[model samples]
Target: MDLAPFKHVLLLPRVRPLALLMFFARMPPAATGVILTLHVAVTLDKGYGAAGLVGAAGTIGMGLGAPLMGKLIDERGLRAMLAVSVTASATFWLSAPLMGYWVLLVCSFLVGLLGVPMMSIGRQVITALVPESRRRVALSVDSISVELSFMGGPALGVFVATKFSTSAALLFIGVSTLVAGLLLYWANPPMIHEDEVVDGPRPKIIEWMRGRIVGVLVVCVGATVCLAGMEVSAIASLEHIGKQSWLGVVFFAMCAASIAGGLVYGGVKKAPSVLVLLVVMAAFEIPVGLGDGSVLWLCLLIIPMNITCAPLIAASGEHISRLAPPTARGLAIGLQGSAFTVGNAIGAPIAGVAIDHGGAPAGFAIVGVIGLLVAGVAWLLARQRKPVATQTTMAS
Candidate 1:
């Protein structure tokens, strides 16, 4: 099949709103690490452990808050939810450093909980606004924006923190978030309108959680765990080796690879089945784990490993959009994003502990094993359902 047809699918006519939403959604990831780093520096007398605990609190808060925000968006319109979330996030972030440790923890939690749903909302909006055939590519682009945010956010955070202070950095993050949200509100992107009256009350969470859709969510959780573990391990390893500065280079390589992979995947007319893609992506870790190579070799391995991240996310988004009821799409994406946030929260600590005691290779090996297991889960999920005739049809 000529893949040229698929290339056009990646280009949406009204992409401005999506781009704007993504810019706002990415601010937290960009700023959170720097905030934490600076918070630790300022509070070292309080204990490094406290900083870690606060960071964990923020992540947990995000994980818990996302689903609730999703439900609200389902009931209310995007504007209301965005306004509430953005305002809350901005207020918490701006005021965070002024508070005591316990209060900071609370504010961080509130910020994270309120801060995260914007990205999920953006994803839901894209699914609703974009045509089915082009949704995968669009989602891939969205994922790329997320990766870019991570790549760029920390650097920005560092600069802000260095130039001013941790409090200033936090303020900057808060302002950026508010600006993004306001821009999105003014833009008023098109969304699927809900009816005033429902046939019945909404389905129970358990009812919504049933079937292949849950499987996709599980895969997302697993993939996020692996990614987080890998990221934590890589950072720790580089630090241990006294090559901490190379961490940025390594991430840049990985992100560059992901961008190329996303473009390639978006262009493929006959992309592999989700199961196959999962397997192929998981296999990329083997090279990473087997080599004890230099930074360049590690960078090389990152490209293939990074390439799969976006496509895997795009696949999950496709599945969630296809399986969820129209009214519940927001909640569905929220649940998926929540799973990812939880996985990230869990992964970093686990990997950090593993690297501290067992060493870097052990940490990477652990992540690799997790990826393999997730691949197996993907295969089982694929087997449970009949394969669709085409990837595009599966997405629809």
Candidate 2:
């Protein structure tokens, strides 16, 4: 029997109501970093340290909020959590312009706390609603949309800030978030409520945490750390070369590469295993260390590095979905999101300090080393499987 026919049945339309909702919802948060930085620079009359604090606060909020929101989705329903989060995000965005540095920090933090969970919930919903065979394609589409938003949000934020005013950028992000949230609420996708189903009661959170699911999360955290390190190092290297102007070009190229990767991933017959994907992704880091500081070389290197990112992320998502129990899927995915947020927050500062002291090449080397370490760990995890006897017992 050809597995291709089985996989074809799983492919769903790329543009669905839920995907549209997530794209818009992610825009504000995606754009916020650039706008918030500019706003702090222009309005707060503060130093880089202060701005860094504000940025850190938002990342921390995202890390804290995502898992909580996932738990909420599990306990209540998608609709209720979506409504609450949207209202919270709208309020934060509208009030952002009026706030001082401290207040802005708090507002941005809360906004991140509320904003990021929607993506996790949306992923959970899609996993439940979409057929198993088509899920990889569907998730690849979602991953591409996320990469596009990440690329566009910062650029748009910078443009609006330069053309109009910082406040104008904030206003745009605020309104976009509100609209996105409301649309998700109205569409009201089917909920995957594990609480309602009576099957020997739901597993306790602690119990659920004790298994392969946690192992998967550990690998996810490692991959995210590598990703965050590379992103920070790449930007720092560009700036050090006195080609800060090329930052956008480099980022655009990387994102474009990821988009291509995602598209290709959607059409694949047998997706690579998570371990294999991580190994491939680690290879992307070699270019970061190998490329000379030339903008052209850097840009060229980014293409291969980015080509692996989306597929790795999509594979990670697939692993998480399959391992997590139905009721805990939201929380599990939320935790996975939190891992990435935390990794980025930690990686950026370390890369910045390394660049300041050691030079840009040092930063890239650091990231490359981290990626290699993570890849090794992933390989180890792949090899150390539970015995077949245990699998048989679990199945029984």
Candidate 3:
């Protein structure tokens, strides 16, 4: 396997530290919801439904706030945005243990609304730091880091909550959030590439937000929809087979597949377009439904499907960086975050309903179809635009 791509990205100054910072930075946010849900259900005695409401509120707020925060980063700058978000996040998690359920709900929304823009910033900085030719590998590494953070963060949160207390878990998140924020503030990686001119007249939203860009965003949503739906279906399938205890094992396998995929994607000289990767991912997920009623079968089936996961994510980031102008790149990446939020929000419900009606197989099949449908929409949007040489280049 060619290690050239990884070496090139790591050789660049600032990329290595930024990657490490982002991995730590992502952990607190990753664990927040699960910790909060466990807190509400176990500690507060509110039950799972109420706990879900709190999680939903936080998710909604994050979805609504992502673009606004991105726009702020565009208008103001990174430090200014980080200052406010860090303070809000710190205050919420620290005080959350004291608040009643209702107050906690409101505070959670506020925190999410002003949450730290870690993910978007990482993408922006990575694009700025790496040349376009090396961006695929850079972002692939970043995507793999994200997979690792999500994997460990929640498990750590659960460990603390179970071994100690939910309040301790909340406090842990608070301290980590503060540390991540301050470290980022001190580092202050360049938000815009030096070569890009920000002083020039900015393009109107209409100019850059339509056609291929919209298609990329659609593919982003479809990608997450497949992921979230597969997760729900996998859990349900495990429960159906009384193998629910294998949840961690299955998820670990899935994450491993994604990491392996990302490593290969980064090493390769060329790759399929965002839409093509999304279609391929969705296509693979459908067959996973056929493995229903067996945990081992489901785990094996999801591996090939998940191999496209990180590649799709990295490809989307590469395209967005190429397509959007420097002036609005933050907002474009933020919209990508929002698209992910939208996909996760709806995907679970779609899968849950399908599972309720038709079992785990239907859950997987239905979400896979939803992904394909959205990919088709993306293809149509891209096709509507007159073919451009730049579009072809950006897709790679």
Candidate 4:
């Protein structure tokens, strides 16, 4: 395997720190939902269903707020957005533990609406800092950091909640959020490339927002639909087989496969199209339902599908950066964040219904089929893309 691609990207100024920043930045948000669930279910003595409602409120807020925050970044700049978001986050998390259920639910939505725009910032910074040629590798590294954070963050949140207290967990998240925000503010990474021109007129939405960009965004949603559904189906499968204890091991294997896949994809000279990767990922997911009810078999079946995960995400980021005008990249990235949020909101419930009616196998098949259908829609939309017009700034 070629190590040169990885080395080249990391050696670029600012790329390594940005990657590390994103990893640490992602951890607190990754654990926020799980921490909230534990707080409601365990501390408040509420049922899991009630906890889920609060979580859903937060998700809805994120989906709506991401684009607004992105627009803010576009208008005012990164530091301005960060200051407001950091303040909102600190206030929310600090006061969250003391609130009653209704107050927490309402405040959760408000807090989510103002949550730090880390994910969007990470991608935008990559596009600005890394040249078009190195984006695949850079984005692959970013995706790996994301996977690592998700892998450790929720587990740590659970451990703290279980061992210490949910209040302690919430406080921990609060402190971490403040620190991450301050670091990001101080670092103050560029949102546009030094070679790129931004003082010119911003393009109207119609000029830059084309069918191809929409298609890429659609694929983003579809990819997450499959991923989130797969996770739910996996848990349901383990529970059905009375092997719930193996979940941590199974998830670790899946994440490791994703990281490995990302590393390989990044090192390659060329990467596949986002649509193509998503199709392959969805194809792999369908067979996971057919595993022979053993940990080894499940892990084996899961690996191939997950291998496409990071590559697909990296491809999506690469495509968005290429297609979107630099001036509008923040908003575009924000929409991408919203797409993933919408997918997460949709995926698990669909899988849950399938699991309830037809068991774990049906959950896998249903989500897999849906993912394929969505990918097909994205392909059709992409095919409708018009020829590019001449411009001062060339989009990828």
TM-score of each: 0.89, 0.89, 0.97, 0.96
Question: CA lDDT of each candidate?
Answer: 0.71, 0.70, 0.88, 0.86
For model 4, residues 1-396, the per-residue Cα lDDT tens digits are 576988888899988888898899889998999999989998999989999999999999898888888888888899999989999998899888899999999989998898887788888887788887788888988898889998989998899988999999999999999999999999999988887766878887688777788888899999999999999999999998899999998899889999999999998776677887888888888889887377778888999989999988888888877777778788889999999999888899999999999888888888889999999999888877442522311122
lDDT tens string, model 2, 1-396? 133532443344433656766766776678887788888977677876788788888888889999988888878877778777878877887888899888887777887787647557656766766665456776777788788878877888889989999898988987887777677777767655333343566667665554455555555666666677677777777776788888888888888998888777777776676555655665666557556478888878768767867876777776676656667778888998887776677666666776778766666666656656765665555445432212211111
Q: Judged by lDDT, which candidate is best?
A: 3
Q: Name model 3 segments beyond 4 Å from true.
A: 386-396
- Residue-pair clashes per prediction, in order, are 1, 3, 0, 0
Error of 2 at 135 (Å): 1.6
Error of 3 at 6 (Å): 0.4
Per-residue lDDT of 146-206 in model 3, one digit per residue for the tens? 8999899999999999999999999999999999999999998888888766786767667
Say which prediction, candidate 3 or candidate 4, comes out ahead on TM-score: 3
Model 1 lDDT per residue over 92-183, tens place: 77776677788887777887777747668767776766677677777777777777777778888888888888778877887887787787
lDDT of 4: 0.86
Q: Model 4, residue 175: displacement in angstroms?
A: 0.5
